[model samples]
Target: MIAIDDILEKIVSKEIEKKEALRFFEELPEKEKSYLVSKLKTHLSNNANSVENNFSEKKERTLKAVTELQLNEEHKGFIDQMAQKLEKNAPKSKENASECQTYFVDQRRTGGLKKALKRLQFHLTYSECDGAYLYDIDGNKYIDIASDNGVNLFGHQPDFIKEAISKRLDKGYPLVGYTEELSQATKLFSELTGHERVLFTQSGTEAVMWAVRIARAATQKKKIVIFEGAYHGLSDTVLAAKDQFGNSIAMGLGMIQEFADELIVLDYGNMEDLSIIEDRADEIAGVLVEPVQSRNPNNQPVEFLKEVRKLTLEKNILLIMDEMITGFRVSCSGVQGLWKIKGDLATYGKIPAGGMPSGMIAGLTKYMNYVDGGTFDYDDESMPSVKKALMAGTHTRNPIKLAATLAILTEIKKRSSTSENKTDESNSCFLQELNEKTRLMCEELNSFFKTKNVPLIIEYFSSLFRFKFLDDPNGVVKELVFVLMRINGVETSPSGNCFLTLAHSDKDIKSIIRVVKKSIDTLMKQNFFYISDSIEEDEIKEDIRSTISTIPDMRNDPEQESIKNDQMEKLRKLIISDLNNFQEKEVTI
Candidate 1:
């Protein structure tokens, strides 16, 4: 087999240009090419971002204080504009104010609200999203990157899984315990992933919890190993070691430090970090990891992952891969499908069960026997329920979401069916195209932005890209995000990273890149080139303050941000509102 380095080294050393290099890659065995592509991309990863001023103490104060303010007219205009773009894949349902009475409180009831409404001319109202699109009360649409946070993969209400769940609804939700739906769902999950069993849970975090408990129970180990700068759901234990600011080292506040003692924070990409606990591997029940850290948009290089697989095996440590984000996005089956990885225990959610709010923990047959089959020699059925009690939650194999998930996965399977080893040409060439497109876009975006002398970084992996909002203390990236939000008919966002969803066509992506290009051009013309490698902190502060000042202050006019104060008063009683709706915030899905 030809190695990836054999190909990339040739490309890097100018033995061949990229086009010829790609042709060489195309002619190689499928596995060889996949390996080579990964190698080639990594070989190009240089620190493309230039350092910018950090947030100042005063700006931090402003952000913290923003919680008390209200949205102004310009802010409202911006919000309305952004809302339209967010509807790219939303279900086309007319949103009548009367229809959403169940979810949002009417803002006309209170005397203060009525008086306030009399005071303002317009209102800005938002609705909760379902999958790929967002709907507004007043006939506006948005492409929903917001809702995919953890569970928007199936493209919403897909017909495949919906029919399966709808049939269940017709059957009266079925009997609750050990039912056929549970069995079939688990069956599909285990079969697809090569796991022996599945324990269904409600959410990704809940599944994370169960995976940890079962690991402790099976190995009788008090400790677990995790990676730094990784988020493993928001469970108390998992949230403990978070790095809030980007030092690569993360620490969490609410988690008890004592738990931190039991948890080993292995610097990502280090296998020796595992050796520190080598003698303690048996004392370690499992190692939990995100195939690719969702927070950092950077991939776990091939070597790091290969080492992880090796160390876990060498130390006899059970591998618990947390696939909540990477499950359906990276490959049709999952990230493990992309790599030759099989975990002893794995967690699934995000696109499985279609898009319905669902989760499950899967384990290999040998390791899962304790949680399955009979306990006390079949004399007690109580043990099975113990697992059930931990796993079950307001379960919705929702017909609509499940249907969407099925469609999404089926398409993924179809796209990925071609194995490099097989003689069949029906391979995941389409996805490879998408991956190539992403790489090109990342490279082009980086080069274009750099040419403008903008010291920003746009990093992409698979279909997702994280735009490193330049180190500009003036919040240029935030401004660009706001511009994307405000642009008509373009629902690009600075959040949820970026999406290369099924609904997003080549044209839609081109529009994004176009806007990004324009924005970079504008920023380059305006951004001051640094005088030397050193930046002027005072100038950064002044720019930030002055830029923020230009936005009309919304603090004095709460009623104007939404419906009139009258409507807002009524709405306030029902809906939770954000005080800092204009503030730049980063969200992970």
Candidate 2:
């Protein structure tokens, strides 16, 4: 037998193909395979400089573009003013929190434009949350639009969910035990999702991981198809991206290349992309879809989803709907329920757990039977029959989580019942009312943007909405927009995705719109959208002098000050040349 170290070395050196390496990896004992995978991940991390060169280049370009744009006279003045305002209002508690965060590894602080955000001291530390509002440490209140990434369906600290969790705690629930709460939660989940069997896990990522495992086990096929631009959690199986050459690549370091090899990512809404699924049907175990991708909420693609469902059924592939962000919040039954399109298997989290960290995989008996070898009764002499797939965790059925989930589902069921009885589809109900409110809010914002020619639009599906740029597809303006929104008393996600909960009143919605409008107005006043073609040379020189004046003092270091002056002179000349070129182009046009 070949040694695991040798196999890993061969994999890292490209001496063995991915498929061949995976085969060897599978033949090893489970513990050895895990060790080998860890070693391989370390190698990938050590060699990430080569793999991540493209990302580094893109980051550099973004930094350069933002720096140059901010150097404009009006923009520089605006930045200076905002910086001063932020400094004055800097929350001491939040500053302490940010300082403490440096001791731990947090993706929230490290991801995106980290350096820029750090320079602005944009870390927000909330002291309390109630309904649709967040109170920062310094007693400043902002309308909460992030919605805890779609987990707070009813809003933060709702009474019913709080009571449920408190009651469960009073009962002294064990970490690992079968309780009546578990049965009730699972039953409610099955009824809501229209699935025969349900399994609980700790998070949405776990639910998705097991869903794929069951699909692969049931069909005896390897590959899973996912759409581009849809986030299905942080599992290695689904962490893939398409390269410029149209080849599948791991989205981040430490993911095995063999896992990327097993994924087929296609365009989300393009009709032509369906043919690839048909062509590769034999190898596909399942097609994973996020009915409404959170990043691009505008592209609902109902027809595309229906066609994908049909193809999966025809091709004997399991349709796995990843409704982590859409479940419960979109409707009582989620996107699958709203569209009346059922999947063979579905994964849910977020609102289903009512803000608790939980995940669920629900599916037909044929597919979910792999979880426990087809349910058997004590009365029967029959034994476990079906081949089982591994699905176990220490806290899979925590009573507190079950209690919270059951409360949320029961509330949803009551509301759904009321909605179903209404003669008119548009009549008032819990979700319907919330969805309608969201629609109106987005319409108002979009209309305002159009009237003002702001080059921004808000798109929504149900209660989920995202801010999209009219032409800034690369997201050059997004960071600045989010910063401005935060400063104007509206808190949103870094990605510009936000949700509306039942707790968000009409007044709260109007306040959100006002903040957005004010932020846009500020940007416009700073000439962020366009640069003037005509400018006097004296005014340009004054702008350069003002820009230099904002720099920190270098009085004690004369040589360094002289070098900085030379660099600033070159930058001023470059800016003038670019402005002249722009004027020439305007004249030619």
Candidate 3:
């Protein structure tokens, strides 16, 4: 019998292309070939990236060999499937890129980015996306849990959005000025968000940047209070970070420290932070917050939100809600509506534009008019015209974006069971249902963690889901879980934030949990969790055994064993925890 290693070696060394190597290896019986492929995958899993780099020169030859062979359809399918999987799993792929590789490779070459990707153990390079799935450069499919950082909430290329774009195209691409589409879009947004008016921008970041600018202008105060772990935008004022000693500082070098100093970073959901607001009331222009912070979505405290509103009101400070993720995501009226507290100003993006590249600042006329070209037409509010903030962009109200937004919001409101004339509680609609589904899934996963004694927990806040490893204070475990999920065909953010849309069916939800469990199993078999110096190897194994003993061997169980069995027990516990968490949370919700 020829060794599989020798065949792989020849392919790697470029002595033969992958097609030739596959033919040589196929001399073995079908069963043996399957076994050999599995073995080869296990051996090359960690080294996939390195192998690609070494064989960069042979890539075209191997690709051409596959095309040159006039194999039967079934044979071609098998080879294609495996080849795509290998390519998707490969660590590097710049040579065959269709788009500019800088988007994927520029940061990847840096030591920090490389190390970060390595720790996660997955390198994603996408070519196209449709619906709720993505097709990578290698043609491997993935269930997109990340949802383009929450922008693709309705999934990719929905029929409504496509139709909207098509209709707009027929109108001759009105890119010059305000079209009927732009007017309709802004009107729809104002109606949905209950904001008196809005100023459109290109992205969520831009929206938040404008929100801060308006707040400072209206209040005539330089200091802006923000919560820790809250992502407002990339603007200089909001790009500041807090140090270990709790001092506010700039995140990157180019950012001016003097401007960053004006940002008062406070702890989210903490009363102490509220007290600081009271102390600095005179100096504060506004308190910017993410009702459900992206980094820790599940940690939103209702009382805290109400408190923020009360304090801001009592102190005469502007309250700016950074609703980039929560706008139209949590509800049509957003977090403020759900929680029954309103912000003086709010920045919106993500699903607001129907998954298009758009953003806007929604607020009362008093603040919004400042950006409406220094015009203050409101009855009671007349500030100095000199205090007005300038806000404009070339694509601010692009007709195509306006058309897409109008279509998306119209659809979302309909799906939410909300009508143009009625003002029903939005929490009773589609958005709530998605959040319920997500919450139940988290509960199921957490139960499995407890059963297996793994120090991990899945958290659900609204429609956002994130997994946490309690012991991983630095978040490496969370990052690894993201890579593992991708390996199992589910892609999400490194923050462990998985955004769900109305498009995700019950089956897709089940698949997400199943793949996540399988990823956990893979990590266990590879002993990836043992990276912690504090945990002993023996205890980990014993914990795995005791937790999964209730189920059949995880590696072979028809229902539980989705992957290999080398560390089957750990994964078995993980899967059951996931399943049970869903079931239990379903009952509770």
Best by TM-score: 2
- lDDT score, candidate 1, position 178: 44
Question: Stretches of candidate 1 above 4 Å error?
Answer: 1-135, 141-147, 150-156, 159-168, 178-180, 242-254, 373-430, 470-476, 492-495, 524-532, 535-589
lDDT, model 2, position 293? 89
Evaluated at residue 50, the lDDT of candidate 3 is 25
**Candidate 2, 79-160: lDDT as tens digits:** 6677677656655645665687768666566333423334454577788999898988877788899999888988998999
* Model 3 Cα lDDT, one tens digit per residue, 100-203: 45465643232112222332333457888887788886666888888878887778989999999889889876566678877777777787788888888998
lDDT of 3: 0.65
lDDT of 3 at 35: 38
Q: TM-scores of the models, in the given order?
A: 0.62, 0.77, 0.70
Off by over 4 Å in 2: 1-70, 114-117, 420-429, 473-476, 531-589
Q: Which stretches of candidate 3 lie over 4 Å from their true place?
A: 1-122, 244-246, 373-387, 417-424, 473-480, 530-589
Candidate with best lDDT: 2
Report residue 464 deviation for candidate 3 (angstroms). Answer: 0.8
- The total number of steric clashes, by the backbone 3 Å criterion, in model 3 comes to 5
